[model samples]
Target: MKRIIPLLIFCFLLAGSGCANKAQSGAGIGALAGATIGALTFKNKASGAAIGAGIGALMGYIVGNEWDKYDEKQVSQTLEANQSGQTSSWTNPDTGKSYSAVPSPAYMKQGQVCRDVTITEDGGEQILAKACRDEDGVWRLQQ
Candidate 1:
């Protein structure tokens, strides 16, 4: 009965927060899952909740922060590319982290919107930078 109560509460909280697309919802659900799992592992609900919330918050912030920076830079690069007739190429400049932009022709035909870009840094890290075209037909970050 005690275990079932916690499970039910967790479900209720997750569903309630999932109603919106806000990042807080992600953190909320993360905390719930973290707490539940932590409790099962350590048999301490308070410790679990605290640990879970801390983990969730940190993960959320990290993922969110990286995304925000990438999105902004991607947008700026896309528009600058469009204006200069040059494709986007980025590098850490300090770390020799370098990558080139591959624009989607479909989006470019519409307005040079670089929705998905391929990034290859010197560390051999290949990443996808997702971007979108703004109301002015200029590429921009989703934020």
Candidate 2:
């Protein structure tokens, strides 16, 4: 029961944090599940939970980061292929999440090509994003 209370509190905190991005959300979820499993499987519950959380968080971050990359790839493609004011849309084959991006006119920023874009997720909120083209002509997303 003592352990359970902390777990519940952790869950509440995780929920309250809003997560913001896939990587953060993944780490929180992984830590929670790892703690639970470690507590059950090991005699030294604290050590077990700590170790499990570290490992789980690493694995989760890798997966979540990959998803972020995939999303970024789509964004980069859209930015490169579509003209300003035209919207490009796609569904992630792995996650089935659909998104659409509408890019504004390109502008020069510090000698590089940059464009502001709006991305909308199906049934979700829209995100205002920016991408810049590098010397190599690759479009990179900016925070």
**Cα error, candidate 2, residue 43 (Å):** 1.6
Please provide TM-scores, in order, for all candidate models, with all chains considered together.
0.40, 0.80
Q: What is the C-alpha lDDT profile of model 1 across 5-109, one tens digit per residue?
A: 564476447536523222445555555666666667766766765676557655654554554455456546665564433466666433344555555433543
lDDT of 2 by residue, 1-143 (tens): 46555754574366347434666666667777776677778898777776776676677667777777888888898888889889988887767899899999899999999999999998488888888999999998876
Weakest lDDT window of 10 consecutive positions for candidate 1? 18-27
Report the number of the highest-lDDT candidate: 2
Global lDDT of each candidate: 0.54, 0.77
- Quality of model 2 by C-alpha lDDT: 0.77
Colliding residue pairs in candidate 2:
none
List candidate 1 segments past 4 Å from native.
Answer: 1-67, 79-87, 92-97, 106-116, 123-130, 136-143
